[model samples]
Target: MSQVTDQLAQFVVFILDQERFALPVEQARGIERWRTPTRIPGTAAAIMGIINQRGVLLTAVDMRVILGMKPITPTRRSRFLLVHEQIDCAIAVDQVLDMLQLDLSLAEPTPHRGTVASRGLLPTPFGFATWLDLAALLGSINNG
Candidate 1:
């Protein structure tokens, strides 16, 4: 197996609604306070439109809608997690909880019947946190 498939990986955990979710730490560029994005016409509903980040245009995606949760207004704890896979985009989250180093062996494969964008489910003291497939998620956005 390759080095990536052999070792533990760090994940940035965050809340969507009542459930917890995470993204690979390596893909996360930065986190910033919620900023309203400029709405673009003819884009997916999950796409909150684009925001200018230090001169570069970054597409902001609403995780709630993508995860099939009811959309809520951005609160004080809301944050934008800047992630880069094949593309650089901002993921709008309810709140950033914590970062954890997870052993890949501990993760359970996500149910095949569920969302295709979920990579696996990491068990925590609170409950199972979905590990998001950033590449698949971005691909869905790009394809739409």
Candidate 2:
């Protein structure tokens, strides 16, 4: 149970294949139903290309490829986590599981499992989710 005074840390929990992963809610603008993007040339292998959402263009990134998983065709259950508004990016995910809220004061220091794409483990009621370092995961977009 949470008290009124407990500061909450919000995370967007999502799935890619069978593995669960998360990113801070603050890092994402919102989640959208997966949309097929127009492929672009001379871009990063993980970048699926650009998508138009509500008249705004977003660079669609395939999280599976970025995380070293096999890419699959998008399905009805797929989702997009919108991020980097200035650069207009959307992260493609298999599914969104939940919006987690944990007491910030009770948070534990995540171990250094050591992947540039991850911050570390995030304890959840169900289990641990791989906490993503969004900047590290997405930085290659601009740098590529």
Candidate 3:
């Protein structure tokens, strides 16, 4: 399929801390307000914890630490984005932004320096997106 066609379809756009981030819309199950996740002992610091969504266990990734941003302090403004990467995972974000058709031509490659495995693509032209590479992001997390 053409890149434009792919871009025009659905996508999940969210705020990771103060920065705006967009991933191909399909990766997310849905976006919702932040919930107090059940903390899992012995997990990596970036893996904040997990949450049970309608009987399914969802892992929550703390984007702030993952992206080298300041640690997130739970507050009334906290939000959770239900992202389904390999398994059902909930990504804690500052907020859920609106969804819109992204323009492929304007899309830029993710920078190679970010903590995110796929840092190449970023949103642009009032709409930006990066193809979601879940395994790469998760694998980068040190289990030990």
Among the numbered candidates, top TM-score falls to 1
Q: Taking the tens digit of each residue's C-alpha lDDT, what string does model 3 give over 54-113? A: 888888888767667787787776777776667677778776667666655655677643
**Best of the two (2, 3) by TM-score:** 2
lDDT of each: 0.81, 0.76, 0.67
Which tens-of-lDDT digit does each residue in 1-144 have in candidate 1? Answer: 112446577888899887898888889988988989999988888899888899999999987876667874799999999998987889999998887777778898876423446878987555778899887776765564
Clashing residue pairs for model 1: none
Q: Residue-wise lDDT of candidate 2 within 24-138, one digit each (tens)?
A: 7777788998778999998788889889989988889987876667885788989888976346589999888898885555545565433344766777775778878787767
For model 2, what is the error of residue 130's alpha carbon versus the real structure, in angstroms, after optimal superposition? 0.9
Misplaced by over 4 Å in model 1 are: 1-6, 112-115, 142-144
Candidate number achieving the greatest lDDT relative to the actual structure: 1
Error of 2 at 20 (Å): 0.8
TM-score of each: 0.87, 0.82, 0.79
Badly placed stretches (over 4 Å) of model 2 are 1-7, 103-115, 142-144
User: What TM-score does model 3 achieve against the real structure?
Assistant: 0.79
Q: How much does each candidate deviate from the true structure in C-alpha RMSD?
A: 3.0, 3.6, 3.3
TM-score of 1: 0.87
For each candidate, how many residue pairs have backbone atoms clashing (under 3 Å)? 0, 0, 10
